[model samples]
Every structure is written in structure tokens, then in C-alpha cells.
Target chain A: MEILALFGDFTVRTVAIGAALVGAVAGVLGSFALLRQQSLLGDTLSHAALPGICLGFLIAGSRRLEPILAGALVTGAAAALLVLLLTRTTRIKSDAALGVSLSLFFAFGTVLLTYVQRHAGAAQAGLDAFLFGQAAALVPRDLVVLAVVGGGSLLVVALGWKELKITTFDADFARSLGRPVVLIEFLLTVLIALAVVIGLQLVGVILMVALVIAPAAAARQWARRLEGMVVLAAVFGATSGVVGALVSASIRGLSTGPVIVLVASAIVVASLLLAPERGALWQLAHAFAQRRSLRAHRVLVDLYRLAQDHDDLDYASEQGMLDTYFGRRTGHVLRRLERRGLVSRAHHMPEEGTHWVLTVDGRQQARELIRPFGERDTTLDGATQ
Target chain B: MTGLQGWLDQPGVTIVLVGALVGVAASLLGAFLVLRRESMLSDAISHSVLIGIVLAYLITGALDTPLHVVGAALAGLLTVWLTDVLVRSRRVKSDAAIGLVFPALFAVAVLLINVYARDVHLDTDAVLLGEIGFAWLDVVRVGPLEVARSLVTMLVITLVNLAFVVFLYKELKLATFDGMLATALGFRPGLVGYALLALVSVTAVGAFDAVGAILFVAFVIVPPTAAYLVTDRLWRMLVLGCVVAVGSSIGGYALAVAYDVSIGGAMASATGAFLLLALIVGKHGIVARALRRRAPRPPPVVHVPEAGGAP
Candidate 1:
């Protein structure tokens, strides 16, 4: 009932819905950005948007969201183009290009921000909130803008899904298919700029890249197909935004953007560790299983070799010798094999302790395991002889 | 000489000197980073070091101690380590790995600041765009002399960086060009790479208080990249990068004074402006290429083979 009442509150509804819209849009667009290896482009664009925001405020002389976003879009696009131009025209690689643009544009924005703060009146009071966003300041009008931009970007993605996919995965092939590869790339860049602009109000400039990247990255871990990735990313993004907003609202002094980013990051960490197939934990488990099976196979082969050398059906190898062969793991492996009826342990004199011999089934399994290494086995036999 | 000494004694002079020292130290290590294609790692380190600073402050209960620097350096290393772990998983590409790790750590730092240090003046804005103009106010006495604390720290860091580069020149060069060969020769290129980043993190921490994180990245990457375009030799690149860093510092200060803007921001913008100029007019610049194309080609040699004709 408390949660329902909180959701019904006008201010909370606006902030929550606004954050969710930004999150979903950023996530959807971020999938393409991540796939293209332009994950840091979001960082560059967000930082690049600061000067534009300042410029917008300077020109409009107000804190209106429209002019601010328009300015942000222009500068964000310019920054992206600048990065591309630098990398292409000069010897500078992409990483250096990105770092240069990110810092330079942000620094320029800082200068502009300081200038605004000193020169402008109290009307520009909340302008600095764009640095580390104040989502609590969101009004219903902001949500309308978010809806238009978010819906428009999503529509563009849906319309150009094929072109974007081919262009992203294989640009040369896209070119061979006579697709307008350059045009498609430009469109994608513009879309990314739009996404960054939409997100600036909620996630802030500094933490906006996290909103664009973390959700998509987390989703990528769980999904195989592009469609699935996109859907999952959108869901994850929306969930983080809503949850982060609620938590921030409930908490006394927490800011919303960092909280949102942290929530998204939490999702990413969880997905990386716990997602089904590509998760790190899954990979570790798979490797562990493979290692165990390989070790068991090795033990079986050793037992079979001992039985062959003696040419005795019930010949038993000393536990001491097996211990030397398998190191400290000999007892564990032999016990497991005995349980499986692949090997039988014989109780010997008190001084001799334990011994093991492979059953007929174990000998057959060992031969089958070595069958894949047929050529190598003859060389091993020669060496042994 | 007396007039120059009087100007030198002013606080502005110390600010510019401190900025220049940061520039020199950052670019010195930055040259290697640019060549190694890990320039963005500097970006990652500068941002994530906030956690280290906050942690150090929390533990030591003071913000000004050397422990902050050490903590930041360790956090920077941790950032690299975490990124490496993510990359090794093969689930995340390196760029995405970088994007993933820093924000998480940075957000944590921000949250901590909001919760615990609300009353303290540890403004996040200050961390982003540090006020180098106020750097002169914090003075420390060394013997009978009073020097700007940031300047002293930067000077020490610059010397340490200079020593590191000077001593490990051959090893770093070999490791950078061919890690396998370096390892075959027992140079342990991996260890050298880590040591270089350690120094970079320390340099970042030292510069962060004076120039802020964004400008620190500009200092670390832009000058070295500009130098890279203008030169072919690593040693020359290092020298040119240092020269560019210092020039940008002075130029940035002049611009800041003229515009009455943030000094650190102006400094970083100056670095960007330098990079743009180098990109246009350097040996391998676009303008140079265009000019070369426009220049009349030498007439095809119509050598009169008099001796051959006679034969």
C-alpha cells in the first residue's frame, strides 16, 4: 500500500517514468554501440554534451529543457564527428582520439559552466544539476520530451534494423550488398547522439555513459540473438531506472543518477557472474568438470596399463605406486573408480595397505578413451618398452 | 633580473609552474601509453581513483596525507586488474570492460561522498574541474622556503617519473614494441607494463588535486599524441611531448586570464588546440599532405643515355 501510494505521487511518478524512458532508450541504442566496439563513444558524447548545454542556456538565457537538449545534440554530434575526423585524418588511433575528445570537450564545458555560474543570475541555479543530474527536479513536461525522443529513436531503430545490423556486423559485406553503409553509419551516430541527449537529464553527463552501457552489457551476457539482447537490455535498463529512482526517493540524501548507475552496474556484475551460458561462473564450472573427467580418464588408463603388463586378470597395483603416479589425488580417483565398478580395491597385509585393479569394463573404457590418440599411443608404447 | 624575480615570487607563477610540472610528468608517461595504445586506460585510472581518494580519506580521516595518493594508486591498479579479469573471461571486450569497471567504482565513490561526507566540502564538481587558481593558497614550508604544496608534490612526481623513464628506457622500448621478444630476453614485459601504469596512477593522483581528472587525462594523452604525429623516434617524441605539455600549460593560463574562466578547463582546451594544429601542420599533417599533392611533381627523368647509344 505504501509503495502504491508512492507510485501515485505526482513528483515520484514523473521522475520514475522519466528515468525509465531514458533507461530503455539508452539500453536499446547501447546494444549497437557495444557491438560496434564504440562503447566509449557514449562517454565521449556525454562529456561532449556539457558545452552544448551551457551554450544552449547562454543563447536562450533560461533553463528550458528544449534549448538545452538541442544544444546538447548539436555538440554531441560534433564531438562524434570530431573523433571520427581525428582518427581518420591523423595518425591518432581511436583510443587516443576518444580520450582527447572526452577530456577536451568536458574541460571546455567546465570553463563554460564556471562562466555561466559566475555571470548568470539565480535563474541558472539548477543548471549545474545537469552535471550530476537531479532527477527529483523532473516535471511532467520533461517526461513528454523523453517520450517523444525515446519513441522516435525506437522507431528509427525498428525501421532501419536490417541496415543497422548488417552495417554493424559486417560493413564490408554491407557495402557489397549495395547498402548505403556510410549513410547507415551516419544515421546510427545521430541516433546515439539523440540517446545521449535524452539521457543527460536523468543520468547526468558524468554518469550517463553508465546508463547507456551497463544495461546492454549485462543483457549481452544472457542473450544470444540480437533481438533477445535488445529486449533484455531494455528490460534491465527500465528496471534499474525505476528501482534507483524509488530508492533515491525513499532515502533522505542520495542523488538519483549515481544510484541508477550503481543499480545498473549491479545488474552487470550479476549477469557476468550468474548468467546461464556465457557467465564466468558457468565457464569455470564447465572447466572444472572437464578437468575432473580428464583426471579420471588418466587414472583408468594407468590402471589398464598395469593390468596389461602383468597379463593377470586379478593383478593389483600397490597404492604407493598409484599415489606416486596420481600424486595426492590417487585415493580419491581410485575410490570413485571402485564405486563405479571400473576398478576394485583389494585389502592387503597391514603393512601393504591398499591396492587397485581394473575390472573388464574399466579396461574396455580405457582402450576406448585412448582410441582417439591411436598414433600417439604406439609412440607411448614404444617409449615404455 | 629583479623584476623577473618579483614576478616569480607571485602566486600565479607558482600555479603555472605547478601546472607545467603536471604536464611534463603526465606527458612523459603518456608517450609510452599512446604508443602502446592504452591511452584510455589513463581515462579509466583518473576517474576510478576517486574511490581510492575517498577510501583513503575514510581510513586516514584526513584528505591531505600521502596515504591518499597511495590509496589512489592502488585503486587505479585494481581498476586495471578488474578490467583484465573481465577481458580474460572473453565475455566482455576490452573497451566494454573498461567502460564497465570505472563507472561502477566511480559511482560507489560518489554515493559514499553523498552519504558520509555531505557536510565536508569534498565537492564532486571540484573533482571534475579542479581549481588550479586556488592551488597557490595551500602552502608548505620546506626548510626556510614556502612553496605551493601542489608544486612540491608535482616536482617530486616529475623527478620520479623522469627517473623511471630514464632508467627503464631500453626495457620499456623493447617491451612496448614486442612483448614476446622482451620476455624471451628475460625482461618480464608484463611486470614492466604494470610498473609503468603504477607510475601513471601516482602521477594522476598528484595532478588530480591541481588540474582535476579531465585535465589530467588531457595532459596525459593529448600532448603525447600530438608529439606522436610530429616525430618518428620515441626519444624525440618524449621530448616533443614534454615541450608541448609545457607550452599548453602557459598558453592555457594566458587564455584563462583573458577569458576569466576555469584555469584547468582552459589548460585542457589548449592541449586540444595544440593537437588540432599538429594534425594540420605536422610532418604527416593533412595540410602538409595537401600541399605535397599540390606541389608540381618533378618532371619524369628523360635521361639522355649518350653512353648507351654510343655502345
Candidate 2:
């Protein structure tokens, strides 16, 4: 109750909301990134935004969020453009081009940051937090900025929905259909860059890739359709943001980004274990049930063979043999089988030790169970008909 | 002109030399990483080395030495191991696994530095940017000649890398080109992978002081990737990669001096520029071929009846 009350505090409440917005935006955009196999683009754009933020601070000369964010947006877009140019103009592969552009821009940003810190003496003027964000320090203005960026990104993505989806699924097809591939790709890249830049204010550059990759990855396992994937990815992202914010608010000195990543990680683990077909638990259970059915079929086949070879097999006498064959006690199970009317005691045998014989229904059930594993010609179904 | 001569003679020249040497070795190892489509792993390893550096400092009380290399190498290898573990045991995709491991490690390193090593200047800026400018300060004088320690170490690493690639060229090339084929040919692709990973780690460790962890990827990836566009044969690509790396290193230093920019950043940018130029102007450039090739035969004109008209 105390913790809940603490969480309700306005400081915690506002920050949590801001975190959620960031996650939601990232998740929605990240689904597109993952589907297109552009996972590392998140890392590239995040790093690329550093110089923008620095330049924003430099231009504005205050700890204000607006100019810094604007700087980040411009630089982020520029970096994406540079990467595109590299891919189109040069023979460099996308991955290599991404690496080159990312490192170069980021290193330049780091150098600027160092120079600012060293020469300006206003090093702690909210610039350092961009590298690894400090959620505890987020003010209401920061929240407002996050909202604007988040809402703006969402609006753009929503409007470009058809175009973005077409390009992502099949660029060639989109081109063939007269859709402007370059224009749509460029638009999507801008939206992606915007998402990355917004995330910088909350999670920072080092961990923003997690925001982009984890939720989308987790959502992919559960979703069969692309639309479902994007929606679920956003939900997972928002959940991680809220949960991570709560945990951070509860503890002193806990960075919000890492906690958010940890929360996202938890979601990934849960998805891996609980998703319908892809879940580990589902696979394990399926395998175990399969083995059980196989064993049961084997037991029935062996009993039928014994009955065929001899006049009858004593149920009580067979319990000992079943125990030896399967390495377990079978007397209780044998009684259950008798109750199910699948097997019966032989009248010729003594009452204390009853001999058993398969009923007509029991023989049919055994054949059904064993049919899948045997050769086609050996199947009993044709003979039965 | 005087400043240029002076700069060339100063120990800063040693920084460029060391940077170039490290660049060559890193790019050599980077070929396989790029081909295997694990280029980002270099970035992940580079970032995670901060934790290793900090831990090493705590344990050994040394700022930058062979011990630093050991710690960084261990950390890089651990990152690779952790990523693989996450991929195999936890069923996380490779990208997500890489994403998960590095930031966590980096955050721990940053927090540790903030809490314990604040007074000692043990921060990521130091670990990432390194003291390339100060490499001259720790010069080892041998009677008449003075050599930068970083340069000497990088030289040794460069030689080792050259030897490894030359002696095991066939195996390395075959394995990198096609792991399945290498395995079918009775070579353990896994061992080769480990060897390559270890080489990348060591190269990163050796280069950390001069170029730092962040820019190490630029060195490792840009050259080989650029070379890949121009050549098909592995041997030629290797040579071309080394040459491109060395050229970029020189150009980067000159550009940095001219523009008064970050030397490492400038070098990376130069390499990227070189790659772009190679990709565009080379004989196999997409635009060039598109221009040279004639259009295919025009599509057949099919007569279509108007909607709801003749069939």
C-alpha cells in the first residue's frame, strides 16, 4: 500500500507516463524495423542523434529540452540520409555502411561532448544524461517534450500506414504498383529517426536498441500476422516502460533505462515460455505427451501379441510382467484399464490371478494408436473395412 | 608549414602510426565479421569493454597496460559467449541477445565508475575516447631512440595478425566463406570461429588506448567492407582492405589536423568516404551498370477489351 502510494506521487507518475510514451513510440516503429531486418538501424540512429543533442544544447545554451531535441532530430535525419547515400551511391553493404556511419557520427559527437565538458564547464547541463538518461531528473517540461515528439511520430506513422507497410513487406512489389519506394522509405526512416531521438531523452543511446529490438522480438513470437506484431510490440514496449519506471521510482539511484531493459527482458522470457506454438513449455509438454502415447501404444501392442500367441493373458499375472517391462508398478493401472472395459479377465484362469483378453473396442483403440508409426501396407484399417 | 613538420615529428605521429597499424589488423579480422553478418558484434564488444577496463583497474590498480588488454579481451570474449548463450539456451535472436548483453555490461561499468572510481577519472569517456593524444607522455626511451609504448604493442599485434591470416589463409577463407562446406571438409568451423573472435578481441584490446573501444569498430569494419565492394577474391580483398585501412588512417590524421577535429572520427569518416567512392565509381557500381546496360525487350502489347464490353 505504501509503495502504491509512493508510485502515485506526481513526480513518479509523470515520469512513468513519459517513459510509457517513449516505449510505445519505439515499439511501434521497431516492429517495422525488425520486419525489414533493420534491427541495428536503431543503434545507428540513436548514436547519430548525439551530435544533434549536443549542438542543440550548444545553440540554445540552456538546460532546456526543446532546442536540444530539435538538434537531435536534425542530426538523426541527416545521419539516416548519409547511410542511405552510402548504400545507393557506394558498393558498401547495408551492414557495413551502417557501421561506418554510426561510429563516425557517434565518435564525432563524443568528441564534441568532451570538448563541451572540458571547455564550457557547464558539462552537467543536462547533456550528459543523453548518453544514459536519468529519469529521476526528468521535469514536467521534459514530459511535455516527450509527449510532443511521441505524439508527432505516432501521427506521421499513422498517416503513412499503407505506404510504410507496402514498402516494408515488398519494395519491388510496391514499385511495380507505382508506389514511390524512395519516398516511403525516406518517410519511414524519418519516423524511425524521430522515435530514436525521443527515446534518447528517456533511455539514452546505449540502451535504446533494447527498446527497439526486445519488444518487437517478444511480440513476433506471439503474433502470426504483421499487424498483430506491431500492436503487440507497442503493448510490450509500453508495459516495460511503466513497470521499469515503477521499479526505478521505488528504488533510489536506480537508472530507469536499465530497469526498463530488464522489464523488456522479462517480457521476452515470458513470451518464450508461454506463447502458443513457439513457447518452450508448449514444446516440452508436446514432446512429453507424445512419449506417453507412444508408450501406451507399445503396451497395448505387446499385450495383444501375448493374447494372440496364447489362449489368454492373466491381468493380475500380467501386472508383474508389465512392471518388469516398463520399470514401474502397473497393478493399479491394470485395474483402471479393466474398469474402462478395454480389457477383461479370463474365465479359465484362477479367480485370485485373472487372465486378461482385449475387447473388440480395445483392439480398435490399439490399432489407431499404433497406425501412425507403421508402414502403409501394414496398416490394419484397410483389412478392418 | 612549421606546425605540419613539428606535428609530424612529435609523438602524435606515433598515435597515427599506432592507429593505422591497429586499423589494418582490425580490418583484417573484420572481413569475416562482415561476411558472417555479425558486423554489429564488434560494436557490442567495443562498448562492453568498459566493464572489463574498470574491473581490471580495480583488481590490478593499473590504468592502461597489458593487464588492461587482458581485462578488455576477457570482457569482449565474455560478451560473445553471453550472446551465444542467450541465443542457444534462451532462444533469443542474435540481434536481441547482442542488444541485451552489452548495455547491461556498459551500465554496470558506468555505475561502478560513478560510485567507486569517480575521483580516479575512471569513466567511459576515458575508456571510449582513450588517451591517444597522451601516448607520447608514456614513451619508453631506449638510449638514443624513444618509441611510444602503444605503437610498439600495436606493431606486435599487427605482425601476429598478418601471420595468422597468411598461414591459415585457406582455412580461414574457406570457413568464413562457407561454414557448412568447411565442416563437411572435416574442418571444425566452430574452432575457426573461436579463433577469429579471439583475434578480434585481441585487436580491440591492443587498439583501445590509441583509438578507444567505440572507434575500434570503424577500424575493424570500414576498410574490409570497402574492400569487399571492389574485389571478389579473399586474398585480394585482404590486401585491399589493409591498403584502404592504412590510407584512411593517414588521410584521417591529416584531415583532423586540418579541420581540428577528432582524429579517430575523422579517420572513420575518411574510410566511409573511401568506401562510398569505391562503391559508386568502381566498374561494378550499381548506377554505372544501370547506365551501361540497355533496357530489356519491350513487353508485348496485349489487347484488352473494355470493362463489360467485348470478350
- TM-score of every model versus the real structure: 0.90, 0.83
List of clashing residue pairs for candidate 2: A91-B279, A313-A356, A314-A355, A346-A355
Query: Candidate 2, which CAPRI tier?
Result: acceptable
lDDT of each: 0.88, 0.77
**Single-chain TM-score of chain A, each candidate:** 0.89, 0.87
Interface RMSD of each: 1.0, 3.1
True contacts kept of each: 0.85, 0.39
TM-score (C-alpha, index-matched) for candidate 1 = 0.90
Off by over 4 Å in 2: A1-9, A61-63, A118-124, A159-163, A170-181, A246-255, A311-317, A323-361, A371-385, B1-10, B51-97, B104-120, B138-149, B229-233, B250-261, B276-311
Off by over 4 Å in 1: A1-5, A295-367, A373-385, B1-9, B296-311
Name the lDDT value of residue B88 in candidate 2: 91
lDDT by residue for model 2 (A24-61), tens: 99899988887777878888888888888888887887
Query: Mind sharing the TM-score for model 2?
Result: 0.83
Predictions' DockQ, in order:
0.74, 0.29
